[model samples]
Target: MSVFTEAEIEYLRSQLLARLATVGVDGRPGVKPVGFLVDFATDEFVIGGYVGSGMAASKKFRDVEANPDVALVVDDVANIDPWTPRGIEIRGRAEAHTTGGAEIGERLGSAFAFDAAWIRVSPRRIVSWGIEGSSFEFSARDVASLPTSKGV
Candidate 1:
């Protein structure tokens, strides 16, 4: 079973961008908007860009190597008339990978393909709001507490 609910997964798949927060070696926090993909096979959020010489040198990649803690937020306004907003916040450990972009590329298709380094996040906690198709209150949970949470 997956850590995320079906509705959450659907929301995740519908969004292409997320705000990734990481900590620098000097103990500073940094957040940036990045293109992200959910790899259900491994149950991780993959963050990276197109295959390029500078990908490995990016700040986010460096931050992950120095510190594994990370948070990712994907959200948007769903409606104007109702003033509806929805989003998911995931806090987890992240690992920097120097390879494994080819598989991600296949899933992204040729136009947005990548063969460069990437970062994978294994969520330990999750918070969501406004996507349950009912109420707008936020719900938070510790993913590790769940029986099938991949023990994050």
Candidate 2:
């Protein structure tokens, strides 16, 4: 079974950009808008891009190597009249992988071909609101009990 609820999975699939928060070795927090892929087969979030100098040279990837803990947020304002905001926040351990970007790129289509590298996040905790039925609904859960596939 997937750790994400059906609604959560659907929300993730519908979104293309997410903010990845990582703590550098110096204790500074860094956040960047990145292209992401929901890999249901591995039940993890795959973050990478074909922009800039590539994922391997990025500071976020280096930060993950130094401090694996990270947070990823995918949110948006659903409406303006009543002010509805919905999103999912994930706290987890991230691992930097040197390869396997081609496969992820294929899954995400031609626009995103991370071919160089990517980061895999194994979610330990999840908090989400305004995703299910109404903006009033909120849920949080610890998914540490689930198995992790880091190197795989």
Candidate 3:
């Protein structure tokens, strides 16, 4: 079962950037733009960034470690005249994974260089808007109940 409809999945594939939000150990909120991929097989979002250094050594990574709760949003402006906005927002638990040779890294392929860490977000709830006429929300159970396509 797929959490996203085929059209929604296609929209995600077309987008390159997503905003990731995390809560710090001290209870401050942090958000940053990230290069990401949707891992359909695992139904998770994957983000990779440099490990051993400045930015990664800072709050966002620490926040994920201390608190796995996170939210990611991927969106784009379709038209300026009509003031149209569309995107998907995902709420999930995230885990920091070893990089430099992980499956997420391979899937990302050239998005980042060597020595990066992966943040895999396992989605618990998903909400999408403007893809169709109205917005739709899906829980993990709703996603699980979707019928699979034949000939997989």
Per TM-score, the best of the predicted structures is 2
**Ranking according to TM-score, highest score first:** 2, 1, 3
**Which residue pairs overlap in candidate 1's backbone?**
none
The backbone clash count of each candidate, in order, is 0, 0, 0
Q: Which candidate, 1 or 3, has the higher TM-score?
A: 1
- What is the C-alpha local distance difference test score of each model? 0.81, 0.84, 0.71
Q: TM-score for model 1?
A: 0.87
- Cα lDDT of model 2 overall? 0.84
Which scores greater on lDDT, model 1 or model 2? Answer: 2
Tens digits of per-residue lDDT, candidate 2, 81-119, equal 898999999999898988877766677563755656888
How accurate locally is residue 110 in candidate 2, as Cα lDDT from 0 to 100? Answer: 37
- In candidate 3, how many clashes are counted? 0
Please give the range of 10 consecutive residues that has the lowest summed lDDT in model 1.
143-152
TM-score of 2: 0.90
Q: Give the true-structure RMSD of model 1.
A: 3.6
Report how far off residue 27 is in candidate 3 (Å): 0.7
Model 3 scores a TM of 0.80
